[model samples]
Target: MRITNGAGLPAINEAPGAQIAEGPAIVPRSASAVRPAGDATTLRLSHAEMQKLPDVDSERVADIKAALLDGTIVFDASSLAARIARYHGGPQ
Candidate 1:
């Protein structure tokens, strides 16, 4: 189902003196609150912090590169595309 930008909204906000009564805020006023989209994404990791990263495997990567260079490994494009599509819940 596709949702339009004006979904759940009236064609015109035809109110002159509409006042929202005082209530608890929908979002909290905190320093770590979520920001709007298109903000600059930055990743600042210190040496000790970077050492704690889980997904970086340089030795395994070097082995894979060597295998690919020596033609011991085959790169299957169709299988890779199918896996990516399944991962993103797209057309299989």
Candidate 2:
């Protein structure tokens, strides 16, 4: 069911000023904390670099390269741990 404002208890905004003591004063935010919207930089590959690379049409290679460039590609910790376990065989 759709219920409008003041359906139950008294509306907060409509309440008396004495009932609502002033809340914590808001401190003005510093300029440094607010970053500009147009301040961001865009990344691009050089034309010469792109020309040097072959198979640009390959989706798999392009995806891998994009992931690496964006720092999304990470080392497989579980695989590394298993490999290390196999190499060590036992505790030192």
Candidate 3:
């Protein structure tokens, strides 16, 4: 169930075809760009935003869990995999 090879990432900077472009790295900042740092930031939680979260259906969840344990639930691995791939911007 685990893919150890998938964990390895190619180092693009050290790759054979990799190129370190030599150009102006730092962009010129405007005079107005330098501003004084503000005071401690205050995080305000919106009640409207909090209320937008969907309420959990405890009974429905329990039924689904029981069905899974009893092997009564119909699960399509390919369909679920496709949905997961689509969600992660992977090939369908």
lDDT of each: 0.71, 0.67, 0.71
TM-score of each: 0.36, 0.22, 0.33
Per-residue lDDT tens digits of candidate 1, residues 1-92?
22235576632533566554567657577866766543533233355577698776999999999999999998999999999999999888
Worst 10 residues of 3 by lDDT: 36-45
**Global local distance difference test of model 3:** 0.71
Please give the TM-score that candidate 3 achieves against the real structure: 0.33
What tens-digit string does per-residue lDDT give for candidate 2 at 1-92? Answer: 22247568655556365454465667678998986764443223455566788766598888998998898997689888888988889532
Q: Which stretches of candidate 3 lie over 4 Å from their true place?
A: 1-54, 76-78, 87-89
lDDT per residue (tens digit) for residues 1-92 in model 3: 12244557654345576665667868899988775444222222455566777699788999999998899997889999999999999997
Q: Which candidate gets the maximum lDDT versus the true structure?
A: 3
Segments in model 1 whose C-alpha atoms lie over 4 Å from true places: 1-55
The clash numbers for all candidates, in the given order, read 0, 0, 0
The most accurate candidate by TM-score is 1
